[model samples]
Target: MKIKDIVNRDVVNLENCEDEAIHIPGLIQPHGFLISIDADKEIINVCSENISQFLDYRYNEILGKRIDDILGKDFKETLREFKSNSLEKKTVFLTYNDQSYALTIHKSQENIIFEAEPNKVPLNEEGNLFESSKRLLSSIEDTNSLKELSQSVATAIKNITGYDRVMIYKFDHEYNGEVYAEVREEHLEPFLGLHYPHTDIPPQARALYIKNLLRIIGNIDYVPAKLYTYVESKVDTLDLSLSVLRSVSPIHVEYLKNMGVGATLTVSLIHKGKLWGLVACHHYSTKFLSQETRNAVKLYGYFITSQIDVRILNEQYEVAKKANEYVDKLSSKSLEFKRDSLTSLFQDDAIYQLCNGSGFSACIDGKVYSNGETPTEEDIRLISEVLFDIQSDGKVITSTFPRQNKGLGSVAEKFPGINFHMLDDTNYLMWFREPTIKNIKWAGDPSKAIEKDKKGLSPRKSFETFTENVKDTSKPWLQPEIDACNKFKFFFQSFLRAILTNEDKEKQRILTENLKAVNSELENIGWISAHDLQEPLRKIRMMASTMLEDQQRFQVTEVAEKRISRMSKSAERMQTLIKDILEYNRASSEEDNFEKVDLNDLLQEIKKELKETLEEEKAELVIEGYLPEVSGLQFLIKQCLLNPIHNAIKFKHPDRRLRIRIFDDQNHSKSDMYSVISIQDNGIGFDNQHNEKIFKIFSRLHSKSDYEGTGIGLAFCKKIMLKHRGFIDAQGQPNEGATIRLYFPKVS
Candidate 1:
C-alpha cells in the first residue's frame, strides 16, 4: 500500500468515534457476582443468573427483596454509613448464613453495587509483608538507571505473585505503549519488546485507569452473569468506573484470547497527575489472588510512582552539572576571543552541544552564519520568519516537520526539524536536523480498517509484526535537549552583549545612554499625587473617627453617628489610594542599579510577604523553571513580582484553590537582551479587551467591595518594567485566569 494510505488509516478519529457504555454492560464476570440495590435498602436488582454458589439465596428471588433479608442488617447499616458520608467504595469482612465471604461494596448514583467473590484465599501472605516491602525497596534502589529500574520492578512483581508473565509497559507521547521490560515463564513464547497500538486500549479505557487502582479478569472462557430487575422503575444508568467485578468489553476479551492469556492484572503508574504507564501481569490459566496480595501490588506501584521524581532529579543533576561548567567555560573564553558574541560561540562550537542537531545556523545582526548540512539560505529565511512570528516569551522554539498539523506542517515539512533560541528579532541561534527515515514495527497492520458492528469498534483480530518505513522525519528531540536550549539562550544573550560592549569603551558608552532609565510622565503624575496628597487624607480620616467616638459618648442622634462613620470610611479609602500611588512612585525611580538579582531568593521573600493572604485563600504556588540571577535594580524587581502574585491570590476562583505557577519566559528572545518572567494564576480573569486598561493608574475592573484594590498594583508593575528598560503584557479570559509577563533586560 502507498505511504499516504498507511498514514491516513493509522489515524483514529477519537472525537467522533461512538463510545460503548461499560456501566450498562448487563453482565458480570462469572468468577464473581454483582448485586445492585436501590436507596430504600432493597435489592431491586440482581445480576447473576446463578447466585447460590457464593450466597444462600437465588438470584431470581432477590428482586424486590430487602438487602437486609439476604446480607443481614449489619451489612445494610454499613452501606448506609458509607453513602451518608459520600464515600465511593467499602470492603467488609462478613459471614453470610455461617459461610465466610468478602464483600466489596460501593454506592453509585442513587443505587449501591455489591461485588462479591468468594474470599477463597487466606489473609496469611506467602511471605511476610514487612520483609517483602523492604526487599522490594532495596531491589529498586539497587538499579542504576531507568531501564534497569523497569526490569527490576517486573522481576520483583513476578517474585511476589508468581504470575506466568509480567511486563513493565511505558506510554509514549501519543499513548502507544511498548513492553520496556519483561519476565515470563520458560515455556511461554515471549511477547517481550513488542509494541502495542493505542487502539488496543482506547482513550476512554485509558482514562478509567486513573479512577480504579487495580483490574483483574479471571477465566476468560467462563460465562458472564446477566443482570435483571423486576421493578418497573426507570432507574438511570449506573457508573461502573470503580466496579471491582465490572464486566470487560467483549472486544478487549477477544484480544486477550488471541494472545492465549487466561487472566490478567493491571495497575496504573500515575506521576504528576498523568498516567505514566502500567504494570501488567498475565496468567496462562484462571488465576486469583487474595485481597491482601492485591493491596501489596498496589502499594508497590504507589511506591515506585513516588520515587519517580528522585530518579529524574538524579539524572537531571548530572546533565545540568556538566552543562553549567561548559557554559561557564564558554562565557570566560568568549571575552578573550575579541570577536562578536555569536562568532565566538560558533568558533568554539558551543552551540552544537546545546541540541546535538545535524547542523547549526545563526542570524546574527541580520547576517547568516552556518555550519554542516542545512536547507538553502532562502529556505532558512522562510522557516525563520515563521518561527519568529510564533516565538514565546524568552526561550527556544522547537518543532518537527509534522505531516498532519495543517498550520505548522505547511511550513515545517520543507525541513526535517528546527529549534531556535532567539536573542532578539535579528539575532538567533538555530539548530536543524537532516531528514531521515523511521523504521517502526506495529503489532498489527495499523493501515487496515478496524472491524465495527452494532456493538462498537472491536480490536484487531491479529497481533503480528508489520513494518512501516516512515520518511522525511529527523530524530525526535527529548525533553532534556529542549531544556538545554532554554539554558543556552540566557548564557548567550548575556555574555554576547557584554563581550561586544567591553570590546570598545566608546561603543559601550553609547549603548548605555540608549538604554538609560528615563521616568515617564505617568510616573511624575503618580509621584505628585502620592507625596503631596497623603497628609490631608490621613488628617481627614483621623478627625472623622474622633467625631464618631465623641457622638457615641455624648448620646448623639443615630443619623449623626452614621454620617460620621461614612465620612471616616471614605477618608480611609482615600488614604489607601495615596499609599498605593506612593509605592508605584518608589518603583519608578530611574536609577541604573545593575546588580545580580537571584530570582529564587527574591521569590522566597515575596512568598513570605504574601503568606497570610495565600493561606487564607488556600493557594498553591509552583515554580517550574530554574531561576537565574539577572542584572537589574533589586527593589524594582521585587515590586514587579510582588504585585502580580498578590493580585492572583486576591482574585482566585471560588470553585478551586488558587494555583499560581511562575516560570521564566521562553518565547521572546530578541536584541532587547533581557529575560521575561511569567506569573500565571487560575483566577477570575477579565476580558482581554481590557488587558491594556488594567495597567492604567486608578483603573478598576471590579468594585472595591468585590475585590479591594487601589488599581495601582499593575501600574506599579508597569513602572518597574519601564525603569528596567523592559516591557510587560497581560492576557486573560473572563472567569478563566490571567498571565502577567514582565521582561527585564540582562545588563551585564
Candidate 2:
C-alpha cells in the first residue's frame, strides 16, 4: 500500500490524537494470534487473520467454530475453570503440531479473548522466577535514594531482558518525561538526563499505561494482522486493552522506528494506584522474550512499585524532622515576644530558611511587614489583592510560574514562585522564590515535537541532544516543603487565636466590672427618685395647698409669697435631674459613629454652646497648644469636652475667678499611636483620693446644696471615651486644680 493511503487508513493525526480509540484497534501484532468467543454460546466471534499460521486451519474455517470443536473439550474445561475464579488473566501452555504455546485468556465486555504465542524459554526458567524476583527486590531495598533505586531497577531489568539499553523514565507535574537513570551498551550513546515534552506521550497513551502494567513490541517493523469477525456476528470492533498481542499505535511504531529501535518493552511502575514512572527497554535488532521471562520481569516490576512509597516517605521524614524543629523555634519566639510575631519571626533569618524562600512578606492586622528580598510595597499590595480575591476557606496556594497569573506577570521576574496562606480577611502570609536560570538538555528540539506534513502529523525524527535555557521560574516546590508550610500556617494561626482569646478575656472582665458598677448606679438612681426628687414634689404640693386655704380666709400675705418662691426653686431642681438622667441613658445605648474628628474644631463648638454659662461664671477659658485629629464620634466628643468645661464654671472657687486651659498633652511619649488631650481647670477641686470616685455616677464629695449638681456629667464623659476605645483619667488636689486627660487611639 502507498504510504499516503496507509496514513489515511490508520494513523491518528496530532490534532485529534488525544481522542484516538487505541483500546479497540481491531488488530494484533503478527508475533501472536488472537481469538475471541461469546461468553454465553462459547462460539467464535472474532479471530486474528494470522491465526491460520498456528491452528492448522484457514481463517474462514475457524471463524464460526465452537471452542470445544476447535481446540478440544480440555481447553473448554480450562476456560470454565479460569472463568469461575476472580483472576484478571490466566495463562495455560498447550502442545499443538509439535510446538508448545502459551495462551493467555481474559474477559472483554461480553466476550472472552485468547492470545497465543510460541513458548521459546524452558519451563525450568519459570520455576526460578520467584528466586530471581527476590534477589532483584533485595538489591532495590538496599538503595538509599530515589536516584539510586531507579538506577538499580534499570540495571536489573537490562540484565534480565538482554535489551541493548534500559532506562527509567519519570514524569514531572506536567507529565513531561525525563530519563532519570539508564543502562546501555558500551558503544551506544547515552540518553540519561534527557527531557522529553509531554506531547511525546499523549494523555490517552498514558492512561493505557496505567491500566496495563506491562506491554512489549516484539518487532516494530512487522505488519499488523487485522481481526476478522464471523459473518453472523454483530461485533465490529474488539477491545484489546488486555490483549497481550494488541497492535501498537501507528504513531508509536513510527516513533520507535525513527529511533532505530527494532523491539521494545515497557513495564509500568505504579505507586498508590497511579502510574509514577516506567521501565523502558530497547533492542537494536528484532527481539522477543519468552512468556516465562516476561512474567518474571512483570513480577520484578511489581516488587519495585511496592517499595516506592516506603522509600519516598523515608526520605521525606528527614525533611519533616528538620521542619518540625523550625516550627518549634517559631512557636517559642512568638510566645517570648509580646509584640507582632509575624514581624519578629521574619526578623530572624531562620524563617526565610524554613521554606527555602528568597523573600517573605506578612500582612498582620492590616499592617504589611516584609524581610529578605522582596518586590516593592506597591507590587506586594497588588499581588495581595489578587490573592485575596482568589482565596477561599484559607487553603494554601502555591505556584512555580507566577507570571502565568493575571496582574502578576510584570513582577514575576523578581518573584517567580510564591507560597501563600490567608489567616483572615485582612491578614495573610507569603513566601517568594527568585528566578534561577536553568539549562535543560532535551532529547530533541521540543519546539518541533509535532509537525504536519504529507503524512498529516508526525513526531520529530531527530534524537540528537538539544539545549535550551529556562528562565522566570524557581526550583519547583517539593511536596515535603509544601507540607512544612502547611504545618507552619497551622502553628501561626493557633498563636494568633490565642492572642485574640486573651484580649477577649480581658475585655470580658472589664465588661463584668462595668455591669456591677451600673447595677450600683441604678440603685442610687432609685433612691434619688424616692427621696431627692420626691422632696421637691412634696414641698410644692404642701405650699399650694396652704395658699389655697389661706386665700379662702384672707388676701395673699408675704409669708404665702415666701412659700410660693421656695416651691418654684424646688420645681426647677427636679426638672434638671430628669434631663441629666435622660442624657446618661442616651450615652449608654447609642451606637458608635466614628470618623475623623478635629479636637480643635470640637472645642470651638463646645465653647459656643457654653458661652452664656462661661460669661455668668466669669470663667476665663484659655486655649494652649494645638490639638490633633483623632478617630471618634464628633457629636459625642463635643459632649465629652462640654461637660468638663461646664463643671469648671459651675464649681469656681468663691475666693477667685475660674481659669480653664485646653491643650494636647506633651508628656505622653507614644504620640504617634495615641492622641492625648488634657483639660486643666483652676477651680474648687476635691481631695486627690476622690479622682476615680468623682467620675462615678451620682458620687458627690460635697453637699448638693453647696454644688447644686446631680454628679452625672463626669460619668457621661467616661462612657464616651470608652466607646471610642480610649480612656479618660482624672488627677486633683484639694483647693488647687484638676486635670482630666482623654487618650484616643490614632487611626491607621
Using TM-score, give the best candidate's number. 2
TM-score of 2: 0.70
Please, what is the TM-score per model?
0.62, 0.70
Model 1 Cα lDDT, one tens digit per residue, 209-308: 8888789887878777766655444443456788887777776787888778899999898988888889999998998877767878888777667877
**RMSD of every prediction:** 27.7, 17.9
- Provide the lowest-lDDT 10-residue window in model 2: 1-10
lDDT of 2: 0.79
- lDDT, each prediction: 0.74, 0.79
